[model samples]
Target: DQQVKQNSPSLSVQEGRISILNCDYTNSMFDYFLWYKKYPAEGPTFLISISSIKDKNEDGRFTVFLNKSAKHLSLHIVPSQPGDSAVYFCAASDLSTSGTYKYIFGTGTRLKVLA
Candidate 1:
């Protein structure tokens, strides 16, 4: 069973439009969530995160919303630009796990911004 899943492998949007990415989890124990963005050949960089205790978190052009009851989450980026083209990964962790945080990542969604 996939604990974390990004059903859409890719998304394309024109510049200045809005882009939305979705993610789902099967494990109820996951309590912390994160979104990471990566460019080609580089490691993923943290974008935003939300704790199970909260429902939403935002940073600059990115926003993440979590529905704990539904075990679902999403990332939204407005005014998508060419520089936003990259692979986005959704990750989750059980912070209570042995008092350590280990990340479980989705396969990743590639976003392309059309200039």
Candidate 2:
């Protein structure tokens, strides 16, 4: 079974610092990983993603890293700000026999970036 897990329920970081969020999975069949941020009563917004073939991917202030051997991944935010405070979710997708894909998401980790 594919299971995505976020070990930390929350994290606090000072403004202008860095925030690191971790995630782990149990399925080798999974090939893609993504991170999302959500605000209260709103839909999640895509933050970043890394494919199984890539070890790391970066986009502006966000970075996503994947460790296929350990079935683990992480998201990093530099210069964390108060506006970055939100729920972060790690998600993995796998291609099925039907030629479609299924996504499994981890329990979100709430980040509070203090000023």
Candidate 3:
């Protein structure tokens, strides 16, 4: 049912380095955004997120920024660790589409942190 069915590209980073994940959406209507990290056999855990009205949001080692004019958003993970390895997902929803929240997810990108 998901639009993104292919295995996403992988990124490798050295431990203690910065890992940057990028997401670009086609729809300009997308208003809310979220970033999630999923480990094998486990549900995704929320990392960070931002709204269309806000340009940036940060939480601890994670930061997410939205560019409404460009229809793009990115996540930055600083001081990456081996335990940070996971599949990262970008999700977005538009309030105009429905009063309730219905998220459209991007094909996950796999991140591997090497020690």
Query: How high is the lDDT of residue 26 in model 2?
Result: 95
Point out where model 1 deviates above 4 Å: none
Q: Pick the candidate with the highest TM-score.
A: 1
* Candidate 1 local lDDT, residue 72: 97
lDDT of 2: 0.91
Lowest-lDDT window of 10 residues in candidate 2? Answer: 94-103
| Greater-TM-score candidate between 2 and 3 | 2
- Model 3, 31-57: lDDT tens digits are 889998999999998888798889999
Extract clashing residue pairs from model 1: none
Can you write out model 1's per-residue Cα lDDT over 1-115, one digit (the tens) per residue?
A: 7899999999999999999999999988999999999999899999999999999898889999999888999999998999999999999998876377789999999999999
Candidate 3 residue 65 Cα shift, in angstroms, is 1.1
Q: Which segments of candidate 3 are over 4 A away from where they belong?
A: 1-8
Put down candidate 2 lDDT per residue, 1-115, tens digits, no spaces.
4399999999999999999999999988889888999999999998898888899999999988899999999999998999999999999988543266767899999999999
Ranking by TM-score: 1, 2, 3
